[model samples]
Target: MATCQPAPTCAPVATCQPAPTSQAVCPQPCPIPAQFGCGPLPKITNLVCATDFDKAYIPAMYQHNMDIIAVASVGAEMAPSDDITDLAIKIRNERIQQNQKLALFARQAGYGALPVDYNEVAMYRNQLMGVAGMDFSARWATLMVGLLQQSQQSAQLAATRATLPQLRDQGNINARACANEIDALQRWLARNGLPVSATAVPGVCPPGAIAAPYGTGPSAPICQPTCQPTCQPAAQPTCPPGSQPAYPPAPVY
Candidate 1:
C-alpha cells in the first residue's frame, strides 16, 4: 500500500511531435461526363416516288421524257394556216379598176394616155394591131393589156397561196400531238404524286415547263364575231293636246 502511494505521487512527462511537411497539393485527372439521349438520329424519308421507277429503267424513261419535251417545244412554234387569197384578189382588182379609171380620165382630158411602161405600150400596140386592127382605140387597148396583166398576176398569187396550207396543217398537227403528249405526262406525274416543282429534285424541270417557252398556246388567231346590226322599230309619235308632234324615227331604225 506504501509503494503504490509513492508511485502515484510522481508527475508524468509529455512528448513533442514534429510539424507536417507542406508539399504542393497535387490535382487528380477528371473523367468526361456521361451522355444520356434517345440513341442515334433516324434517317430522313424520301417523299417523291415514281410507280414505274425501277432503278434499271428509270434513266431511260427520264431521257425519253426530255426528248419529248424538246420536240414539243419546237412544235409550239408552228403557226396556224389561213387563206386570204380571195381578199388579196379583191384588193388587186380594186387597184386595177382605179388605174383604169385614171387612164380613162387621162384620155378624156386629151392627155397622152399611153401605158406607163414603154415596153408595155409597145407590146399592147402589137397585140391590138394583130387582134383588133389599127381601128382599136390605143388607150382602150393599153388598158385591156393592163387588166390582163393584173389578172395574170392575181392568178399567180392564187396558185402560190394554195401551196402552203398542207405544210401548215402538218405543222399544226404535230404541235397539237406534242402538246397532248406533254399534257398527258404532266397529268400522270400529278396522279402518281410525283414532285412537280423544279427545285424538288436536282435537274428536274420547272413547273412552267408545262406551258411556257416549252409548251406554247395555239398559234391560230381567234376569229372575231361579226357585229350584226339590228333593225329596231321606230317609236310612235306623241301628240300634245290638239297639236300632233313631229317625231324623228328611232335612233336604231
Candidate 2:
C-alpha cells in the first residue's frame, strides 16, 4: 500500500513539447510537356545519280570528236612535204589533244566522257565501203566540209553552254580554229577540184588572227583620220593648156 503512493512530480510535470514537426520538403510540381508528335513512319529510297547535268552535251561533244577523226583520216595520207598537208597534220594532232582535254573536263563535271576504248575511227575507216567507184579523198572532202562545220557548231555550242571557265575558253578556241580549217579546206578543195560546201558560218573570225593586245576580232582601221584634206573637191587641173593630152596625141591625127 505504501508503493502504490503516486510518485511525486519532480518540479511540476516537465512540459513535453511535441518534437518540432519539420515541414515536409515539397518537390516542385513538374510542368506538363508542351510538345507533340506525328502519325506514321515514311518510306525512303537509296537510288542516286549526278545532279545538274546536260544530257545532250556529252554526246554532242563525243560526236564532234568523231567528226574531227573523220576529217583527220582524210588528210592523214597527205604528204607532209606539202605545206597544206603539214598544216593539216598539225591541226589534227592539236585537235585530238584538245578533244581529250575537253573529255577530261566533262568527266570532272560528273558527266560521262567518251570511253577510252571507244572506236571513234571505226566508222571513218570504213567510209569507202559503200562509195563504190567514188574517189575516196574527193568523196571524203565532200563529207569533210560538212563534218567540220558540224564540229565547229558543236564547239560553239560548248563555248556558250559550258559551265567550266576553261572549257568555255577552249571551246571558243576550237571554234575559231575549226572555222579557219574549213576555209583552208575549201581553198584546198578548189585547188584540187574536190567538192566544196557553200554553207557559211557566221560569227567566225577572219583569217588574220590576233596580232596585238585584245585584237582577237576583225582588224581595226587606222582610227587617225587622214590629215590631208578629204572633204575638199578634187582640183581638176588643165593638162598644161591641153598640150598632148591624149596618148601620142591621138596618133598625130
Candidate 3:
C-alpha cells in the first residue's frame, strides 16, 4: 500500500548475431587453349602484359648501350676500358635470359596470349641500333676523308654534323614508336578481359557520346603512355641456396 515496492530489478540480456561466412573470392581461371597443357591458360592480365612490355626496356637499353660502346671504341685516343664493356656484356646477357623467359611464358599461354603487335617493340629497337651503327660508320668515313685532305675535313665534318640531328631525330622516333606500341599492347590486353580495365572501351565511342562530369577533363586519349608500366628493371627471382646471385645493376645507358 505504501509507495510502490522497490522496482523489480532486471538483469541485462545479451544478443548474439550469426558469424560471417569465411568464403574467399577467387578469379575464374583463364581458358587455356589445348596446346598450353593443363587446366586454364595462365591469366595474362593487362598488368602482366604491361610488366613484360616494360621489361622489354631491358634488352632495348642493352642494345643501345652496346652500340654506343662500339661506336666510341671505333676511333678513340685511348681504347674504352674493358671493365665497362665486360660489365655491359654481362648485364645484357642476364637481361636477354629474362626476356627469353618472358617470351616462353607468353608462348606457353598459347591462344590466351595477347595479339602480337608485329613485334613492334623489337622492330623499333632494331631500327635504333641500325641507325646508331650507320651514324658511327658515317662519322668514321668522314674522319678518314678529313685526314686524307685537310681542306675537305672541315666541309665533310660540317656535312656530317648537319646530319647528326637527323640521326638523333630518327632514334627518338624509334624510341617513341616502341613506347607507343607498348601502350597499344596494354589496351589490347585490357579489351580482351585479361585484366578487365574498368574504363577501357573495346571499340571507339562516338564523339561526346559518353559525357564527362562538368569539371573533369575530356575523356582520356584512346591509348596513353600511362597505361604502360614504368621503365624500370623488373623484380628478379630469389636465388636458391648456394646459387650464384643476380642483382639489378644500374642502367648502363
Candidate 4:
C-alpha cells in the first residue's frame, strides 16, 4: 500500500483488436498454366534432350494455337459475308479436331499444352486486319492468306528440321493439318467472292462450291459421330548406329 497509489477508479479499457473486418477476397488466376503450358524444365530436358528440336517444336505448338484461336475469332467477324457461315464453322471445327490430335504427341511425351493466351490472340487479330477503311472481304482474305502461309511454313519447318523421330512424326502430322486448314480457309474465302492466291493449296472443292448437307456441326467428316482414329502411332525407338543390333536378341541361358 505504501507504493501503490489508490486503485485506478476504472481499469483502462483493455486494448482489443476488433475481429479483423473480413473483407471479401477475389480469387486469383493460377500464376502458372499447365506447367508452363508444356512441361517442367527437367522433364522437357528428358524428353527432348537433343539439340534444337525444342526450337522447332515449341514454335510449331505456338502456331498451332495461333491458327486455332485467331482463325476461329475471325469466323465470328464474317458477318459481312453471311453466305459463308457454314463453311467458316466447318473450318473452325476441322482445326479443332486436328489440334486435339496434334496436341497428343506432346502429352504422350509427358509434356502438355495450354490454349494460346488471349493477349496473343488479340495481337494476331490485329495483325490480320489492316487500315480501317479498306473493304472487308478482299483485305481480310489477303491478310488471312498471309497468316495461313506463315502457319504452314512453320509447321513444315518443324517437320523437316526436328531430329528426333517422334518430333519428325509430329511435324508431319502438324504440317498436314495446317495444309488442310489452309485449304479450308482458301475455299471459304473463294466461295465468298474473295480472291485466293493462285499459289495457295487448292481446296478440296473449287471456289464457290457448295458445302455438303453436313459440312458444319457434328455431322462433318472431321467430327463424325463415330470415334475416328485421331491418335496416330509414335515413332519407335532405334539403336545407335554402332551400338548392338537394332533389335536385341533373346538372352542365352
TM-score of each: 0.16, 0.48, 0.21, 0.43
- For lDDT, the strongest prediction is 2
For candidate 2, the lDDT comes to: 0.47
Off by over 4 Å in 2: 1-55, 78-84, 116-120, 129-134, 198-253
lDDT of each: 0.27, 0.47, 0.30, 0.46
Question: Sort by lDDT, best first: what order?
Answer: 2, 4, 3, 1
Candidate ordering by TM-score (highest first)? 2, 4, 3, 1
Which structure is stronger by TM-score: 1 or 3? 3
lDDT of 4: 0.46
Rate residue 218 of model 2 by lDDT: 20
- Model 1 C-alpha lDDT per residue in residues 1-253, reported as the tens digit of each score: 4454332333332322334443443332221112101011000000011122122112222222222222222222221111112222333344344344434444554444433333322432343333232222222222222222222222222233223343233224333433443344344335546532211000222121111122111111111112233445544444445443334433431
- Candidate 4, superposed: residue stretches over 4 Å from native: 1-50, 54-60, 127-134, 163-170, 173-253
What are the RMSD figures for all models against the true structure?
A: 46.1, 42.2, 26.6, 26.4
Candidate with the greatest TM-score versus the true structure: 2
Clashes of each: 0, 0, 1, 0
lDDT string, candidate 2, 1-253, tens digits = 4566555543332223334434434333222111100000000000001122234455445554654564565556643336445655766787678767767877887667564323445544455344432254555555556556555655665687666778778778988987887787688778877657622211211122111222111211101111222254434443443242333222211
Clashing pairs in 4: none
